[model samples]
Target: MTEPRICSDDYGILTSARDWLAAGREPALVTVLKTWGSSPRPPGSLLVMCRDAGHAGSVSGGCVEADLLERYRSGELGELPTRVDYGVNREEATRFGLPCGGRLELLVEALTDAAQLDELLAAMDAHRLLAREVDPASGRVRLRPAGPEPTFACGESGVTRVFGPAWRMLLIGAGHLSQYVSRLALMLDFDVIVCDPREEYARDWQVPGTRLVTLMPDDAVAAYTGHPRSIVLALTHDPKLDDLALLDALVSDAFYVGAIGSRRNCELRRRRLRDMGLPESQLQRLYAPVGLPIGSHTPPEIAVSILAEITALRNAAAPSAGARSITAA
Candidate 1:
């Protein structure tokens, strides 16, 4: 069992902003709308700030956080949706901790519409990716379903921002390996769920910041039928538990689907899925023998291997270690 994790990304910040607004603090939400030449954080990163000098999330990776806070204290940032830039010059870049020639552009919106924040959170809970568009002049806001992951954009009329759930994982096991994987998932800002039907194994599962479900893998897999931005990890190594979820994950739109096994077992699993009539394209999406082949034997090492591959996939980079490709039977 691990202690609860501290969530520092948009997931935590947005939720914190909702709570802060309810507590009578009208916080402004700052967004990194654009960056150029080696900025610390990527576009679309967020920071929620309050007048009393409290803040959540990050826009500069701690480089300009103190400076931003100092401005708030000095009344330099008035109550307005303002545009700001940092690292514009060499000395300023060094002072702000940006890369030598980095630049960051921000949109600081003083949010008064608690209802809009509520709507954004609701859409996320419903597993819907939303685009929140704001017109600078009129201050009109519109929220709608988003198409795909895109960087924040700005035009003459307005700013467009995308909001969605944090990364999530469904681990089909609750053993020691699952423990390690659960810890890694939480560290990566993923909402984790561990499912195992065996009462004996489930009884002692005590990882914090994760949901423990005493349900069969098939039923657990059914719960996330069409989930996007999720990873289905079959670490139980039991055919009964891993197979059902792996099958469902392959057909689902989850960004990643994987199972833990040896190369031979992965081949067997591939044949089994092919017999189940899965399309070749879909079958190719499954990373059986899941994780980079890092020669890992311990639970922690294996967990690292798994996260490395997931990180690669998330970043659109080639897998770091040796990769496994399952051919159609």
Candidate 2:
């Protein structure tokens, strides 16, 4: 099985799309439109590969890429983009190594237009939701804004599905804790950015797959705009740094924002943020003394706790305020 890595998968797709557009090569993007019965990935997962750009995302374990690549190589698919289904029956299931009677489907479309690729890339960059439609007969795909309604295409040759928001995280410091957080967040498929202006901390920082900057906490917070899919964590104990970031995270669309501090310290910090024009309702979003009550003291252990809390919040789709409080003491 391909040990799935987020950076590898996401970057592969983005780079391949760009290269295909630049080289004027019309390539097909195959995404797992839907799955059923113990599939590896859920709905809306993607596997984008072309004759030129390898493959990104996975459909069924690892059994589908080689076949998809062969289809792309031969003229069987033609030059037009088409949505195709695989593993829809028992015989096909055994071929794909899907246990029992598992099945999967794909929307394969030869990306002939730069405009469609550009739009999808732009939506990804902005962390917005996008719904793409592809006709199996004509091999044409359409891009549009996604609505609240959940829709899936079941036809043999059409692809209709949503590409929701990108995973994102905001690290409030560039110190050791921030480094650990950033590294782990990348593994969890987050678009991570670390903010700190202290020269001592920013000078010797190095973590791959994370954006590092020396922006002030308040200014960095201004950039978040509180989107619903974001998570913010303040690692620095420095009041100036943690406070402003916490303030911004409290008001933004960030689903989780936490600060590292003792219980008493968290109380004081909350009071300060509340005094700084942050409403009581907004302040409720702040997750001070972050992480579950695991009695973690070491940096890595603390990081594990923090990541666990974030995962729980995401999977539950619950607000931070309503989450059960952690009493590490």
Candidate 3:
């Protein structure tokens, strides 16, 4: 409510809030309580703001951001837990940059302490999923282990928000495609790890915020086996690398295992994996020709397609690459 500042990194918001609070600045945390129609961000999205106008994370993609910033700067938002709705009318929609008839509601809280944020960040650092509940009405706060990403609630005890382990992406190759994929994945909050045993490819590999490993793709896959949020993608297009990683990953608890290939090659790979005694069920789980069929032809475009499919799978919005639909799961 003080001064609205917003960025797009979900994981960085808590850290930013911690820093702002430590700096003796007024930090306000805003969450997308609900939405209607074509909203840029979905429910549970966060926008952490400070009195100095510094922001981390986003509630809306853009238009609404400017309005929030202006409102906050004008001190129109009083110092209290408040609810705000945007785009209720046609003019408001246009002014706030919402799509036709789009609407969203937000809950704003001026946080006083960083203790809970410290705990949440610690849990995430330890690779533990935790739900931090805040009772703005009573100032009672608590943190507890979280289950599979749940649809959080906002009620009498206030809001229960999930602060989970970073999503993991294992890229099997260090080529151009993997380079683009890794960069984009990091922006999406994926803890990216690239495995390419070829020394030639490894030498010049330099993508900040991503870890590179020189090992057989299968060996890399083994290390990530049973990871709940892991999405393994083989972009090398070499059978030795892609097939081996796919074999190991498909059998693991990894939610999404994918490989880049042509449509015809996808069928061939399926047959080969089938001959390797990989069952039909597990084979079905494989996302061959990995990515949504987006008519992608360049490395960056291909990277987007891949991430799009991964996002879909992460939300169970569609059946991985086996199907494609824009609707929510």
The C-alpha RMSD in Å for every predicted model, in order, reads 3.8, 5.6, 6.0
Clash number for every model?
0, 5, 1
TM-score of each: 0.86, 0.77, 0.78
lDDT (Cα, tens digit) per residue for candidate 1, span 173-276: 89999999999988888888888999999999999888888778878777743456778999887887888887888787777888888888888887888898
lDDT-wise, the better of 1 and 3 is: 1
Candidates 1 and 2, the one with greater lDDT? 1
Candidate 3 local accuracy as lDDT? Answer: 0.78
Q: What is the lDDT of residue 232 in candidate 2?
A: 83
lDDT of 2 by residue, 167-234 (tens): 67878888887777788888887878788899998888899777777778878767753666668888
User: Candidate 2: where is the Cα deviation over 4 Å?
Assistant: 1-11, 21-26, 51-54, 71-85, 89-91, 123-140, 145-166, 316-321, 325-329
| RMSD over all Cα atoms, model 3 | 6.0
Least well predicted 10-residue stretch by lDDT in candidate 1? 320-329
Residue 90 shift from truth in candidate 1, angstroms: 1.0
Find the number of clashing residue pairs for candidate 2: 5
lDDT of 3 by residue, 126-178 (tens): 65678878776654668888866664677665788887667788999999999
Runs of candidate 3 with Cα error greater than 4 angstroms are 1-8, 61-79, 134-139, 150-158, 186-189, 224-226, 271-279, 295-301, 315-317, 320-329
Between candidates 2 and 3, name the one with more favorable lDDT: 3
Rank ordering of all candidates by lDDT, starting from the highest: 1, 3, 2
The TM-score obtained by model 3 is 0.78
